[model samples]
Target: MSSVPITKHGAGLLKEELQRLKTKERPAVINAIAEARAHGDLSENADYDAAKERQGFIEGRIADLEGKLGAALIIDPTTLDADGRVVFAATVDLEDLESGEKVTYQIVGTDEADIKHAKVSVTSPIARAIIGKAAGDVVEVQAPSGGREYEILEVRYV
Candidate 1:
């Protein structure tokens, strides 16, 4: 499989979730399943059905997380030496030319993108447009509504 890029912080979060699922959630669901099985009458056991469904979901998630971790290329933004160009895991400040609004975004992998936190997926239009662009560069992004322009203000590794 190809290596998937994930920020160091994002990798940490994934590891935490994997640990919780294995240590806490997995065991809890196993116990619940056992308790439901003890009730007997599998055909009519609602608890057994629910517990099984949850177990399936938990197992699937565990597999997914494991795969991601295995193929992950964890990048620490602070250690990036990409000069002033915007790249994955780089935090960038930009000014909207039309609206005159200033905003900041950290370019991250798809799984780690959180709009509320101003972290954008590298595949996002704005991020793609600005990638490899240095400060003071003007980029035009094709948005769903229309094309929009932004001026790159600053790029930081940290």
Candidate 2:
């Protein structure tokens, strides 16, 4: 599989989640399954069925996380030498040309993108438009509503 880019922080979070799943959740579910099995007839046991379903979901998530970590190319933003240009994992400050509103976003991988936290996926329109662009550059992004322009005010690698 191709190597997927992930911020160092993002990779650490994923690793923490994997550890929790293995050490805590996985064991808890196993115990729950065992308790449900001891309840008697497996055919009519709703607890058993529910436990099995939960176990399936947990296992699937574990596999998915493992695959992602295995293919991850962790990049530390602080170590990036992009010279003030907008690149993967760089936090960029921008101003909306039309509304005069300002916003900041950190370009991250899809798995770490969270709009509520101002983290955007690299594949997002704005991130794509600003990639490799330095501060003071004007970028036009094609949004679902309409095309919008933003002026890059600053780029930070932290």
Candidate 3:
């Protein structure tokens, strides 16, 4: 797969999770499986079955995280030199043209996106529409409720 854009903080979070999984969760799961196997009967052992399932999930997640981290292109927003235009990791303040409501969002990767935290995925409609745009630019976004207009009010690298 192609390298995905990820903020420095996002990359750090992934690395921390990977470390925890490898150093803590992986060992715990292995111990659980071994203990379950020591219970004698493997045919009707729910504990053994459950432990094996958990082990599968843990291993799969570890591999997935490793792949993502390997293909990540980490960037620090503070070091960006976009000259005021919208780009990945840019925190933007926007005004709804129709409702006159204001909102802020940071363009981030899919793995780091949290709507409650105001972090939007780079592939999201709003992010796509505002990318390469500067303050005072109006953008039309295709929303489920229909097309909506938003005016860019401010942009911050952080």
Candidate 4:
């Protein structure tokens, strides 16, 4: 499997979730399953079935998180020095050429992509178009609406 690119913050969040699942959720589900098993016939026990299903989901998520953490390549944006070029973990200020609206986005890993938080995935169309660009450069992005042009105003590491 290829290494997964993630910011330091994103990696930390994943690790924290993994820990919570293992230590807290895992134990709670185990106890729930045990209690459900005490409810008599296993065949018709709805609580047992639900607990087993929940356990499966939790265990699957735990495995997925472990695999991702093992393959993660965490990058700290504050430590990067790519001159003025836009790169992964770069926070870019842009001006929409058509609407004249200014917005900022931080290029992050897919797991951390949250448009509401101004974080975009590195694989996203807009991020791809601006990856190697510097300040004052105009980039054309193939957005869902259509082809849109944005002028780079500034690039910051954090």
Q: Count the backbone clashes (under 3 Å) in each candidate.
A: 0, 0, 0, 0
For 59-103, candidate 4 gives per-residue lDDT tens digits of: 999999999999999999999999999999999999999999999
Minimum summed lDDT over a 10-residue window in model 1 is located at 78-87
lDDT of 2 at 126: 92
Instruction: Rate residue 146 of model 3 by lDDT.
Output: 92
User: Estimated TM-score per prediction?
Assistant: 0.99, 0.99, 0.98, 0.98
RMSD value for candidate 4? 0.6
- At residue 143, give the lDDT of candidate 2: 86
Query: Which runs of model 1 end up more than 4 angstroms from their true locations?
Result: none
Q: Across residues 1-158, which tens digit of lDDT does each residue of candidate 1 receive?
A: 99999999999999999999999999999999999999999999999999999999999999999999999999999999998999999999999999999999999999999999999999999999999999999999998889999999999999
The residue pairs found clashing in candidate 3 are: none
CA lDDT of each prediction against the hidden true structure: 0.97, 0.96, 0.96, 0.96
Which residue runs does candidate 4 get wrong by more than 4 Å? none
Q: Residue 131 CA error for candidate 3 (Å)? A: 0.1
What does candidate 4 score on TM? 0.98
Ranking of models by lDDT = 1, 4, 2, 3
Over 74-158, each residue of candidate 3 has an lDDT whose tens digit, in order, gives: 9899999999999999999999999999999999999999999999999999999999999999999997789999999999998
RMSD (Å) per prediction: 0.5, 0.5, 0.7, 0.6
* CA error at residue 59 for candidate 4, angstroms: 0.3
